[model samples]
Target: MYQKIIKESNENKIFQYLFKSKENFVINDIANALNMSFPTVKRVVDILVKKNIIVERDKIGEGVGRKARVYGFNPDFCYSIGIRITSHSFQFILINGYCEIKKEKLYNIELDTSSIVDSLEECINNFIATLNVDEKKHLIGVGIATRGIVNNEKNFVEFSNTDSFPLRSLESIRKKLGVPVLIENESNLAVISESILGLGQKLNHFVCLTLSDSISCSTFQKEQHDSFSFKAGRIHHMNINPDGNLCECGSKGCLGSYISDKALILEFKKFFPEINDFDEIFSEKYLETNFGKLLINNYIKHLAIGIRNLLFFSNPEKLIITGKICKYKNIIKPELLKAIYTPNHIFYRGEDTILFSKFNEQTGILGAAIFPIVDSLF
Candidate 1:
């Protein structure tokens, strides 16, 4: 059993290495990197190749000597479906093994679980019907990215402010879809996406801050055991201000209350009663006004406080900001940095430590889709 565990560990390492690099590697290169014997590496590689997970991509060297074959993961080996359920819409995406979106569909619907599950079934069926039989054979499973307290181990959503979707709803979706289903907190998935495909890719320690209807944070770090671990929803309820406004969670000055879209909208209404949507609030017409600047400044100040608290606690190498608020990153980033550098706080990191997410709206979905693929390999 010990020998088997070690062998599986090596295989997982090799798979993760290839998946991350996206480069074709020869047996010698993998063996050296993994600190394993060439024979053992070759044996594992052969198994992966036969399983259609990896393929011989190219050959190096001319006819003068035996050409070394380079291998890489086959991008079409398997596919995953990612579903993002929000307060007003459902986003479905079909992703290939390479984490590329093959197809996507969006539906604006009521925020009830029954409606969502019904819509999801239709979407999955329509998506599957579009693929060729051979391509369909590669379909592995589905992942649902949601907002709220998710019991990932049980594939259950314990609670959410958006709607009343119970744990059994996940099982219903799985039974109807006839595939393995995974349910995870959307913020957590966003962190996963950043870690795998965005700015956090190479970082050993980082934090992801998502500002949407509510504020959320996820932290990633390499543990003492040399294994990666993450904690989701750690910063939402953190008290950033003691005398600040009340939050939906019934707390005063919570991070979520200060930086969420709802908070911004409420603050905007105080200055510009006519503003409705985020676009209007962030528009040049509003931004040029004193009220707009004031609103933005206040928002940035509060956000900076929350961010400062995060940095003080985690001291992460990088902080990635995602969600709807990132659209105003150009205007907000500088102010946020300034707030952080004020005399009240002492932060040594440069401006480069902060970054906006690269994947935009698809970040959560892509992360959800990649979860099963990563789980299968590791």
Candidate 2:
């Protein structure tokens, strides 16, 4: 009975206390902060250290009797693999306990599920081969963040109309890999990491919207316990304009239909056939061109509408714009600001805090790499 009680307590206490800590802490500090007895906290810390779950670092004190040891999650005790599979490429990253990427590699692979799995497996195996034999013992599990509908509980890709629908499960690949695997929507994972570890760390509520070739939103909520978590935001197929061109997602005026970089590229091609790339058209000289201003205006207007929808629903403390869209932030900021200044929202009275996603191009990969550690730690 005593053992049963201790085991149950361990589960609830350890995670609860760690979740409450902003960062690493000494035993005494944790005890004092949580108002728990020193001996109890010390005992728990010792047990955790012995289990290789938490780490101890010695700290020197100027006026103390004995230097206290600070404890942190034993980042090196385990390893996690995160892969971001996108429509255009796949990026694999190996992260240790401290959320540091020990190794990272990227490859361009076909978007087909089977081909992606094959390429990813090759990369993982190659990475493992390169690791020193001793380090292999620390590998824990793998996490994958991908574009499209993911059945989180089932660890499967439900569908990705970007390529096909009714997609087959990723379970077969996971089984061959022979480790616990987690598959999540790429945008959801991005928000989760950004909220817990990235710039959103300080905000209680926020929306992280990825404006790549696709537009998706995710929301972060602060729990009563003070831990911040994220959930995927709404994804609608509505068009940006009733008269606008149809989207691949079968939407008439969806944000992706007009504001996405792909959308802009297509528009530029139609208006300026001589332009070969979006990057070229967005060059410095183009900024002075009437065409550039027109592109920026329409892009900002569509984005503003989409962001407005998100704000109306989540009432986020901040809204983060990420992906290729961030590159044109200087162009879009003024227009986005103008739209937000006008009152369409009724629930919140003040201005919404707007932020550019600092993670930028690394958001998907970094967030995916940190997923396993975040999962285990929290």
TM-score (all chains, Cα) for each model:
0.86, 0.82
- lDDT per residue for candidate 1 within 184-220, as digits (tens), equals 7777788778877788877888988877776677887
Once fitted onto the true fold, the runs of candidate 1 whose alpha carbons sit more than 4 angstroms away are 1-8, 113-119, 152-156, 161-164, 224-226, 241-243, 250-252, 269-276, 279-281, 347-352
Ten contiguous residues minimizing lDDT sum, candidate 1? 1-10
State, as a TM-score between 0 and 1, how close model 1 is to the true structure: 0.86
Worst 10 residues of 2 by lDDT: 1-10
> What lDDT is reached at residue 162 by model 1?
41
